[model samples]
Target: MTASRTTSAPSVDRLAPWGFAAFVEANTHDTAYRPPVVDGPVGPTIVRGGRELVNFASISFLDLERHLPVRRYFAEGALAHGLSTSGSRMTQGICRPHHVLEQTIARHTGKERAISFATGLLANIGFVHAMSSAAHFDAGIEVRNRDTVFVVDRDVHWSIWKGLEGLGYGRNVHAFRHNDVTDLARILGRDRSRKTVVIAESLYSADGTMGPIVEILDACDRHGAISMIDDANGFMVYGPENRPYAREAAAIRERADFVMVSLSKAVGLEGGAIAGPAAAVDAFELLSGTSMFTAAIQPPTAYAAERTIDVLAGTPEIVDDYLAHAARLRRQMHEAGTPTLPTESYMLSVPIGNDAVALQMREWFVEDGYLVPVFSYPAVARNQALLRLFPHAGHTEEQLDGFLRTLATYRQRLGL
Candidate 1:
């Protein structure tokens, strides 16, 4: 037998000098630093660096993450369902909690049916892919043509674009001016012969602006197009007195052919949902790529979300409190000469217009015991950086006052 020659494999350091590894290493310096580590559940207050910080970085608008009832539900759910689903819904992941949550979502959104996904981004991608695919059209819905066009809002979440791309309809996607109903109408008129889907977000995350959803839906109705609303940011924030589906535009919700929402935001849980006609939702459940591939949401999360909906429904005051706090923060910011971008949601965007200044302001806020995320390129257009603030119901008056005062000081010092 011949003796085998021993040889050492090349090290990662050698490979890191070229190709994708080198590119990533070189670009690491261009990215923002990792945020301070948190030690507990996210809420109005977060423990970081051994100190408590008033956290505006969280999207928990209702502060449900720290609510005793919500926490209790989470614990009970974990005890009952373990920690993981261990399989996709198409397999063995479907559970009683998931079905219950779907039913609650359907009832809450006034849709014929609802389906849940692992996350909001996945939900958007799956739903859009299903809606724009040939298989979905062949499943029974009448379509004018196989050539479908997606007229989407220019500022809709990237997930929407990704979904369209995944379905091979990227070239067919057209964008209207952000939140401009007239521009959307113009785009719809340009192609009345093609089967079109008009997409818009109920609340824009980056700019903290809301689209004219009702008008957009009306335009779709008139143009023989389907209207899809990504209500990820507005689902639990905007509505009659902060109640879900209670917006001044509530009457037009039914006019929208599809609605997608994120439970991680105001609901203080982790999951996404799509609400629509029973037939469409049923088809999406069977045909969407994510539905077939991604594991179902953890049972605990579904249980918590379902319980959250019940809590919100029973205690409307919670929603009212959140909206009230948001309004107060907006009002105070305006009074302090730091008005945010015009918005109707809980988020407030303070446009710094310069990336460097926004980052500096965020640092200053952190130093002053407040944590706020600075939105920069890709999240917003180039040079349109902003400090995004999420006002929550759990925030105390003192905390809000301190934050506003710090902001005012920073504005003066930085000449923003």
Candidate 2:
């Protein structure tokens, strides 16, 4: 998801979850079975087209969405309050659900304030815009927007890059190699005079790799640079006192200037947020065009997200067991000679490195009754597409073992 450009269109033979006759035919020549409409709840096994398949494409690693309490809260909230906020938060003003959700987020992340947005993508764009504009009072702590430099990780989400579009800071923007502290240090040390902002994610979504959080912070500190962590996948999953991973989780919130999390990921709901000082959060809400113009998240989902955070904190064992399964799968993949991408998180990606073979491998998984996702072309480097597998906590041992067998068979058949 690095803030890179993708000029080519996505490969759409069966990439989507539902059928699109025109799209499938127009994109590729494959006549394989189209994506079928799923039925009922999303879990270890998905029902579609009168057949059950082992599921491997859901991001709800803890399966909190399927929990009885989560469902009850969501259903009750929706019943009590109808969907839709009716207007943007600025125009219609804030609701109780949104306010409580923001408070929970701010408390969990140790930030003085937090502001929610409709999506993580919107959050990134809005943060970048609000921080990089001279119209705002702080404007890089009195430094001009044109003078402030943006030093980003080579591979950040595209939304961050989109926020920088037409800012007229052509050479001012610098990119260091992904997770390379030396490169980051070199870029930061070169120009000590400029006010720099280093942007990077806590956990990359595409290949499941993690950024060097502590090291990144140290670099920003020495260079007098502001740090922003896109913790879309790491917020409730890593950086907290009760989170499953990252021993220094609590330190992240205290160190980073800005921490953004996705309600859609660990919270098991929709929307995104930025947690930081009260002043910056207030300014962002008022000045961000992306935030001021867009509608807020619905009431029920916000309430569910607020409760889900507590539910997740209370149940760390679920995440612990799931990560154990993911580690086993990663080891098994290595023993079978199918190496996954560099990722400590549950995100497991097996590189196929060729678009045609990736599509063929997906077909094989489908035949074996598993709906595996393949990323190619624009989403990833051309010819560097891979298989993205999501191992859920609810999946049984038998299901995971069978999927491993499928992988071994594919590796041998492909002769890679």
Number of clashing residue pairs in every model? 2, 3
lDDT of 2 by residue, 1-416 (tens): 68987697777765666667555667662534355777997777888777788988876667775564887887877887668788878777887888998999998888999999988889999888878776635645442465667888878999988987776543668888888999999988786545678999888877778888889999889988989989998877775444344653655777988888888776667899989989989988766667788888788888888888877777776666667878888888888788889776778898899988998888788888997888877778899998988887788888888888888888888898
Specify the highest-TM-score model's number. Answer: 1
TM-score per candidate: 0.88, 0.86
Q: What is the C-alpha lDDT profile of model 1 across 1-416, one tens digit per residue?
A: 99999999878787755686655655442325544567977678889868788988788668665454777888899999888888777777478889999999888777888999999999999877776666535556543223678889988898988887733444577889888989988988877555688889888887877778778888988899988899888775555543533543483356788899899887878899899999889888766688778877888889999988877777667777777778788988898899688765678888899877887777777778998889988688888999888887788999998988888999999887
Lowest lDDT block of 10, candidate 1: 27-36
> Where does candidate 2 stray beyond 4 Å?
1-26, 29-36, 47-51, 65-68, 136-147, 192-194, 240-248
Candidate 2: C-alpha RMSD after superposition: 8.1
Model 1 C-alpha lDDT versus the unseen true structure: 0.80
